[model samples]
Target: MLAADAVRVVAFAGLAAMIVAGRASLPLIIVVAVVETAAGTLFGTTEHAVLRGIVPAEQLPDAVARNEARGYGVSLVGPPLGGLLFGIAHTLPFVANVFSYLGSMIGVALIRRPMRPAREATPEKYGAALAEGVRFVAGEPFLRAVLFIAAPLNFAINGVIFTIVVSLQRHGTAPAVIGLTETVIGVGGLIGAFAAPMMQRRWRPATLTRLICLVATALLLLSAVLMTGVAAAVPIAVTLFLAPACNAALFGRLAATTPDRLQGRVLSVIFLAAGSASAAAPLLAGLLTTVWSGTATMLIFAAAVAVSAVVATVSHGLRQPAPELTTTRQAP
Candidate 1:
């Protein structure tokens, strides 16, 4: 992960240079996006795995909630800061991203504790190792439920959001207002992240998971029914208010329960499932909006999430008691 961030620093610097030289093109942008995304994915998976080593199992939830808080805090600033820097110079945002990666690399290097447990290198095939991870997750009812709930949830939420943003722009909503909507959403997430630890203590993980689905469905339906950009932002913001607790409950449990060796692969599979759906969402929303009203598009997304809510409500794995976090960390 540290190495991946180092590579990102160099990659983003190269992109900045290309832009400064007026040689940047669509293909260059595409290449940068691909590299950054792949590297970011690697960094994210490794970060989760490494957290297991750094923090005690019982404290993983609080640690994850703090991380979520920090992420939302950054989201509250990163975009507008990037935009300001971009206005100053085309290369400025890229340059700033390069520095951000460098900062992350330094943070990783400063960690004195072992990030991964000692393990002997074996002549294991990569495919076989990956399959083992997949099989492990598939066999675990909790993980399987997470996968099923998360993927479509990501798809629907992202699709509805895209439709809302695009529709807002089409209706000539002020850019500042649109930006403010994002800020409000970020604030909602930030607040949720801060409250997550308490919420986790008070509620079953399954109950929280079900509530997230139900709330998201309700908010999406409200957004569809209202069909006004700024008015819809309220429901969206309220929806985001539940996100941090859900993530901490779900992923914190995952980090606590999953074997260290399978952490990267298990997380990679789940992230890929969710991310693939997200990647397709905007495109599908665009296509849908061309043929149907924005309300209709949002309604379709709400319906999808509603089904997930039902699934989550009856999920047997979720009904089981949350996994005990008493297990010691395992060797990678």
Candidate 2:
């Protein structure tokens, strides 16, 4: 609840300040980018908390899959809407985003659950609480192994975000065309998100997770290995489709395993782990490409993700019941 309010306030203030200041500038863009990253990280943490509190143990996976679908559904709307508005005017799309954010504030006002108190430790015990959260996460064999795979994969692929955009521009794709390409990937993700529950019903989350990883990895390898013409775009686009669905399942697993009373702490810890990856991505990506050609770098990243695949394949963690899956209090 607080996080939601903070988003509206920060965004509104930034928008208002930018508008009043007259010219939109690089400084403003950098600030907004920072805020945007923070907002997404915080929102993810909030969603994890909500799932821990509201969803029952058995329903958590389906619940998270549905939430993932809903997010992509929003993406289906937001990206196209932004693209359509961008066609009208660049500044207009941002102004339009402002209105959508305002609508969110109105929706938040309508929420009935009174905001709860600090969800983890007391003020004085924060350090100990933080340590406890870290220790708890370490104790979870499943999560630990998953991260071993995911962290390096995250580390490797993050560079592609910029590298791909740069590669696209180097190939002379227009800005609008890049947006169109993104929309294509978004379409693929929209399809995958809806299909996740059906997929999960038929296959275990771990199995499903592996399948998406394979699809993404194969695509990555293809793009890097082929590196010939516009055809390279196809495989990267395929990778885009698989990433979010896999992430949704991975997070669903995490939410199921975290305790409600410690949900905020645990989720925050997870956010920190992810944020560290993102924080390092650009620098690492730049350093990597400097050491090797872009295509070689991409292939290297593909291989790194393959390491994650192997970890996921071998870890017995994926098959076991989540240790803290239920809402029960810990035994004294």
Candidate 3:
């Protein structure tokens, strides 16, 4: 994590310098973007591994919830702050991000706990090590179901969000109002994060999974029905309200069941699975909007969400209870 932060500090600082010197180009921008994304992904995966090590197995749910809350809180403020900084100076936002990574590096340096248990040395080939993680996830029914549900679910949800933004922009809605709508929706996620640990404790995993799916499906459909930003905002807010708890619940189980040695690889695989569909969402949404209309695109995405919900609700793996968190963590 510390190394990842250092990389980001260098990457962002270089980009900011380029912008200030009027040396920024399309290729330079793309390279910087890739470096930053890779560094962020490394930091995130390591952070999860560190959290699992720092917290006891039984308390992983609350730990994950707190982390989710922090992310939600950042989402609420980051865009507005970045935009404002950009308005003041084109390079200001990148400069600010550079400092943020420096701060993160300092914080990581202060952590005293070992991030993983000591294990016997066993060197393996890169491909074999990677395949081990993939095989583990593939063999685990619950984890397999998570990948199955998350792929389409993320695609649909992201598509819906992109469509909403495009629709609002095309309609000539004031920028401030659009930002406010996003803020309101982010608030819902923040509140949901605060409530996640309790929800996990009270609800069975299967029940919670079904509730999240059904509610999201219903609310997404409602958002599609009402095409206006303000009208869609209500349902979008409600839909996001369930997300943090769902993530905490799912990730908590993942942390509990995955071995310490495999944490990074396992998480990488899961993240890739979860994010792969979402990567294409914006382009697909744009194409759909161009071909038909924003409203029609939304309806199509809503239908996709509905299909994912049905699949998730009925999946045998998801219906089964989550693995119990024993005193000793699961072995690799």
RMSD of each: 1.9, 4.0, 2.5
Clashing pairs in 1: none
- Top candidate by TM-score: 1
Can you give the TM-score per candidate against the true fold?
0.95, 0.82, 0.93
What would you estimate as the lDDT of candidate 1? 0.85
A best-first ranking of the candidates according to their TM-score comes to: 1, 3, 2
Error of 1 at 267 (Å): 0.9
What is the per-residue lDDT of model 1 for residues 139-166, given as tens digits with 9 covering 90 to 100? 9888889988898888997787788888
What would the per-residue lDDT of candidate 3 be over residues 1-332, giving only the tens digit for each residue? 88889888898899999998999999998998999988888889888866677777888878888988999899988998998999999999999999999988888888777777786587677798789999999988888877877787788888888888888888999988888877877888899899998899898666777788788888887887787657787787787778878888888888888888888878888888877789899999999988988878988877777776787777887766667785443343
Model 1 misplacement above 4 A: 327-332
User: In candidate 2, what residue range of length 10 has the lowest lDDT sum?
Assistant: 113-122
Error of 3 at 136 (Å): 1.0
lDDT scores of the candidates, listed in order: 0.85, 0.67, 0.83
* RMSD in angstroms between candidate 1 and the native structure over all alpha carbons: 1.9
